[model samples]
Target: MSTHVPFNALRPGVDAADVRAAIDRVIASGWFVLGPEVEAFEAEFAAASQVPYAVGVGTGTDAITLILRALDIGPGDEVITPPLSAAYSALAVMMAGARPVFADIDPARLTLDPHATEAAITSRTKAILPVHLYGQAADMRAFEGIAARHNLALIEDAAQAQLATFDGRAVGSIGIAGATSFYPTKNLGALGDGGAVITRDAQLAARIKRLRNGGQTSRYHHQEAGANSRLDELQAAILRARLPYLADWTKRRRAIAGRYRSASVPPSLSVPREFDAGHVYHLFPVLTSCREAFQAHCLVQGVETLIHYPVPIPRQPALAATNPAMCPVGDRVCAEIVSLPMYPALSDDQVSTVMGAFSSFVPPTR
Candidate 1:
């Protein structure tokens, strides 16, 4: 009998006891928001991210927007970002009252092309926001060089990449600041929506802390107009409980991806090449000319599949007014990419089932 493989599982497994204890601790403290739990988690996560500070926020989207706002990047400022990531990446740029310029991605890397990003820069370009798609770090070295040359702020959209590294340096530490999500599906996810901004800049971290909590400098003394986007104590405590297992979870995700990479698939399907061995494999995506048919085939084989992004950010109806430049590589990638089941909870037998589904597929000849 073939085993059914899920796209991802979120229920408590090995960390159930720890998660329960964390919830109980938070409840017993009688404090819910911006309390000891959030403070402790911020310190722990900052250390984990190899950064000096971390600020907890309500969501990943807020994390990115708060970082941009804290940098004083808004209104006429332009932020160049890849067109291939989750729409939230671009949405965050807009949320900061800045315009997001769409840049084509590297066909192989599926990340913002450095050349494209450089070409997109204008006098108004204030920052280059790069998403580390699918737990793989973007070419941060190149981005760093470009930012230095152009005097642009480099903010990493690391919502999909936690505990990911590029060239021995942690992802969140390389940029001016990095924003990550803990939306119950991340590597170090919480029980509910949560996020944080990781940065080595003390001033920037302090600014974000104020911005996330209604721009309060002190108790009831509003310094500026800030949004209410604080990460509550329960979620923080829950994330703290799960943080220790991230390394092992990342290893398991990589191991499963290795199996998928080595497995034989139909000639029509292509597994994305790993640009760096440090990838945490957030989502194991495969490209096929016939995505619908391939997905149907996988479903028939009892394996679930999803599209990380079905449409390029520039092409979305919400962004049409941005008058974004054409991103041919990103456009093609959106149509072809499909995410297979990838999570630490997947059993070896289930991993085999996913591979078996791929092996048995026979794409229709065009």
Candidate 2:
């Protein structure tokens, strides 16, 4: 029988003993939602990001929407963001009743091109929502300059970049406010879907706290009509348990990425470059002109691979008024990027197996 190495090896209990214990602890507590667990997790997460406050929300999408809504970015407001990203960040803009203006990415980092973001600005542009795609922070220094010049809110979508830093500061802490997800696949994932809006701004944090709780300033007294999107105590507990382990886990992930970078491969394939304190390698993206054949070749070697995004943002039908001409880099990058197996749990043998898969790869013959 062939040994099969999957794209993501994330199994519960065996992989996270503390997570299992936390779940049991929460279950016994009887108070499952918006309790001490959530409060503590929020505090701990805020500390991890070097921020003063973190408001827990139902999901990453809600975190984004709440942050946007708290800032009063709505109706006629335009938020500039990278076109090549998970649809939820852009959709959050829509949820907040704002228009999402697609901007081309820097081909090198695959984050928003600072020039493209600045060029997209108009009187209608009220904010810049930059996604730290694939566990890497964007060039915040450039973005800060742009935001200051235009007086636009700089919000970070840090769903994939838990504990990832840029320059000397944590990614989520640099912007006006940062939204992050704890989806099962994320580096700092909870047991299920969870998210938080972290910020140094106390007023923004207060507004978000109210926004997530049906706009209740107090118990049962509604202030403004808001969505119910509180993060549950159980998930928060799981996150708290896992939080202490993240730094070390990231180190292992870095080691794997280093190996992948040093490995010799076919001329057609190109691995991502390491950025100092910027990338946490959430998904190790490798590009190839011949993506389909490369994926097929890996499959034959009993190694699995997947694409982070197979379709460009403009190509997605759910989004309205999407134009591929507006984001040429994203259009081309989507066609070629493939995610190799990259989770902290991956053994050295598995890493070697993937490297071996690369050595045996053959291009498809016409």
lDDT of 2 at 146: 96
lDDT of 1 by residue, 1-366 (tens): 689898889998999999999999988989999999999999999999999999999999999999999999999999999999989999999999999999899999999999999999999999999999999999999999999999999999999999899988899899899999999988889989999999999999999999999999999999989999999999999999999999999999999999998899788899899999889899999999899999999998899999989999999999988888879999999999999999999999999999999977898767
What is residue 281's positional error in candidate 2, in angstroms?
A: 1.0
Candidate 1 wrongly placed segments (more than 4 Å)? none
- For residues 34-150, could you state the per-residue lDDT of candidate 2 as single tens digits? 899999999999999899999999999999999988988988888888878898988898899888888899999899999999989989999999999998889899999999999
lDDT of each: 0.94, 0.88
Error of 1 at 56 (Å): 0.5
TM-score of each: 0.99, 0.97
lDDT, candidate 1, equals 0.94
lDDT of 2 at 24: 92
